[model samples]
Target: MGEVKDVPLLSELLKDSPKNWGKWGADDEVGSLNYLTSLEVIRGVGMVRSGKVFTLQVPMGAPEGDPIWPGRRTAQRVNVMDHSHYQCGKGPHFPGELHYADDMMIMYLQGSTQYDALGHVWYDDQIYNGFEAETTTGGMTKASVLPIAEKGVVGRGVLIDMARYRLKNVLDRGETFDHEDLMAAAAQQGVEIKKHDILIIRTGFIGSFYTMPSDNFYDNFVEPGLTYSPELVSWFKDMEIPNLVTDTIANEVTIDPVSGIALPLHSALMRNLGVAFTEITILDELADDCAADGQWAFLYVAAPLKVVGGSGAPVNPVVIK
Candidate 1:
């Protein structure tokens, strides 16, 4: 691929951003994910020279202090054996001869490190590919997260360690950065953004979660994330990035800098361009490994649960260098 040169600003791209509604096709459901072609997977495979792997998913049930989002439940595990008829030394088996344990969990699919499906966000009653925003109660016929889960996300992953480049423990809450900032971080790390790549940005926020009070971290702390700007969205579109992963709750700044719009990044990327997001990922270890080896590109892989009609699903993403 060639270097990205002189890309237009968000202001210039907004007019055409909406025009992308039918660019893939009227019946297209996989939006920007179309960029993750077989060629891209080949390129990703070529990046795995080190053979070291890093898991990007935070541990399940790790965020147990309080609910981050209202109505979103923390994961809970229960021993199902209690309810089972089979018991040790009972009717099903002889004493100490056979023992079995069963367990079950209830959780919000998007509660942890997860990908937001194309139907996860929308603008003014429309979803990706101009699908009308209507579905039967808790189910969806189109734009559900299942397509992504089925296809699986595989590509070259590039890490832009903003926290390390900026020399901050963590980017302060409410801090916003633009395209230039991202480019600078990539340049500083001797990496290049390529077409169809899964971009991972490290704010070092997830590391802070362990050191700070849960209440302070969730309630009082504003998060540092990408700026919700037309320029940033334009850059992603121009680069043909299929998916984004960030070590922050909201990929964009917590509070929208733009007036009247809440999550412009989500709207532009997910709703309009079909770009997916894996938010609240743990990237500190990956960033550290990249920095140590001086290699920022790796093979990224993620498989979401095949939840029918789900808007989003928790993901266990891995980066192999």
Candidate 2:
């Protein structure tokens, strides 16, 4: 696409989009996640059959470095104390001569595979649940990741492997898909995406990031993902989806080809409908297994770190089959 100024504003594009604000109550922070009631938890647990488990987080500080959004740096792990300190006789002393290494990591809250708080993005000066955008000025005070972390996300997760469905190892950059494509992929996998299902879509985008040249991966800076449409947004609301997990930087196409707008779904579905977003997940292993066994539905469980007043939090979603 061209410069962002050439595109329609998100507020204009999503002005007619549906919203679930105040549906859960005025004090609500987590939006569509409210759909994951106890019954939804039980429905997720019932998807477990083979006892196989998959962790959907990529390495945080890999040798090749973690993948992050543009303009954000990779995680930097610093060793505050190590055996070298003891060797140099400058380490802290203990009564029993105990030795230990301590370290800390500096990274964006959304740098790793993570869940975005409902208040992470907004237009019109309002976030999910009508929280004022100013509430996120210094750090999120309302609708922060803390609330979502405390609530937790547990539900049946249905995997829709769009790459496999389309007979490709990975979709082309800037490519877009929608709810109709998702339904078609689910049908191809012989699974039904039910209400309150934690929808996980795989385009093989994030997986390819590791092997391809970083420059090439980010050259055009657009990601292949679901695009914005009123019908797509309505489908999410009508289906009562609780969360959307994907192996991409952003869950939606970076820029809408039609309106020339950028990540309009961030405004339509997340900011408006209050649907949670899980991004940059590692789904190759899970996608491979699902393709092999033809089992696409599973119990999905994830608990983001309880970072008080955070816009987003890192997470390692667990999937059980």
Candidate 3:
């Protein structure tokens, strides 16, 4: 209801991050609050508590197969140019200089398992829930996605290892995970559904998306367990979970018969219902930790890049044990 502003803002102080340096062109690297000025700031979003959470990358770094989508934008090697400061003299901005960096791998990130930002989807040109398509662009990072306070996703998380559920045993990489398989996985794990809970699906497709046929461009039919039926999407959107994450590239896959293309659930959830989604992330690292400790609920965190109207982001989420 207010307005996004670009007043003299305190610039960001860098800490030698190989990726994304150009924060105000180096002249403000003293970690001083001065550069914070003139940085185009917005703080409508409440203080993020996920500051203490964990992350599981699914569509991260072009996991395995052909990570491109309808646009055919092939995933380039993750390359970040300079990161240090390029001090060009001094000024009231204390540590003054241009904080610059090229070759920066910038991806608009979402919160947990890394779902699509509210700006990522829309139906017939309109954004999610009650957003207008024409007016949803170029927002400040802090104000990019829905405010952490408004629709912040802090809820119970359940993992359904569809592959294991279907095979009736632990699965190896590249195993097929279908809808029927997901149910079995839930039954085996004794996991139940509840309101406001985030669902983390494991199809064991992580490795494949990263190995073997490296350029396995997402095709509709014949793709293994990496996909699901359109009904699954409809069901999830209807269930109205806060969000749905996964240990795979995309949640539901290219079901030629189901949705007639790749990314079925994406359209169903994002375009239709505005359900946040995450791509590839690192989740299995804590699988045993979670199972051993019987910990399903975690203080999840997803701090995506504030790419201002960007599609998605690369995140380093941490889950507090």
Candidate 4:
């Protein structure tokens, strides 16, 4: 429903206008933070203003590995035992040992490279934007992401069903996704993206993970895959998106048709800019509802384990309409 502008002409965007040698300067415009979004591709149209919060979490099973999109691993059945218990018959076989069975896992939170709350990941031994790392710890032990309590999370949420649009020949899922794709989807549904809004995408890849857990788990090449371009990243960063989420196993597209690498979105967002990502959500029900209601956006909330100094934490996000 929106206009296409020749794949955003990465060469130009990298330059300035993203085509004709940029706008006014730098031939090497690697990161200037200019942004643009059109409401042409409307998604989560109705849910954006919903009163209740939406849920976006999937049930946990045994730890599983995605043959495709390997940016993050999955929870599957595993042998867990708390070392503190009488394993070999002792006063204390092991302290802080495993207890919960495969029944629950702490893998979905910040999504793999999980988030280390302001209490975690410190810059120059400092936490968050300016909190000193020493202040977070007792006796100068210096805390990491572990101490992150539940209060650290709680915010508004929005979702875009990019996958659904493609199926109706509305959004282009066959081609690489760019910033405009988001706009186009929004416009088609008559929705607008606002500031500080957490954007979620449903790429249709969630099916295999849901319907055929065994096959989707083992097969490397499957349909409903999702991906994002650097242009999209620029837009989100410029928009200052606090959190990003997806219904698929991997937040980013698995295969890089151009570079043949895995997780271009994840690499660019995480290792590159440190944007928070959420994955493995049970969006099928939501997707179905979105299709029927023609609304995509919804209020979302997810709380992940406050693991310390860890790469990621496990979370169960909920989206409400």
> Which candidate model has the greater lDDT, 1 or 3?
1
RMSD for each model, in Å, please? 6.4, 1.1, 15.6, 10.4
State the local distance difference test value for candidate 2: 0.92
Q: 216-316, model 2: which lDDT tens digit per residue?
A: 78887889999988999999999999899999989989888899887888888888999999999999999999989989999999999999999999999
Q: Order the candidates by lDDT, highest first — what do you get?
A: 2, 1, 4, 3
TM-score of each: 0.89, 0.98, 0.57, 0.59
**Higher-lDDT candidate of 2 and 3:** 2
lDDT of each: 0.78, 0.92, 0.45, 0.49
Any idea what lDDT model 1 has? 0.78
Candidate 1 residue 62 C-alpha distance from true site, Å: 3.6
Q: Pick the candidate with the highest TM-score.
A: 2
Cα lDDT for residue 47, model 3?
22
Task: Put down candidate 4 lDDT per residue, 1-321, tens digits, no spaces.
Answer: 123442333223223211211231322111111111222113323345545544555555534543223454554444444443345544332367534322335443444323333233323443332335566544223323443333344444556778666774222223456568877887887777776567777665544454466554445443334455556767766776656676654565555555455455554553234445566565667777776776666655556675545434666676667
Alpha-carbon runs more than 4 Å astray in model 2: 2-6
Model 4 residue 305 CA deviation (Å) reads 1.0
Error of 4 at 287 (Å): 2.3
- Comparing candidate 1 with candidate 4, which one achieves the higher TM-score? 1
Quote model 3's TM-score: 0.57
Ranked by TM-score, top first = 2, 1, 4, 3
Candidate 4's TM-score = 0.59
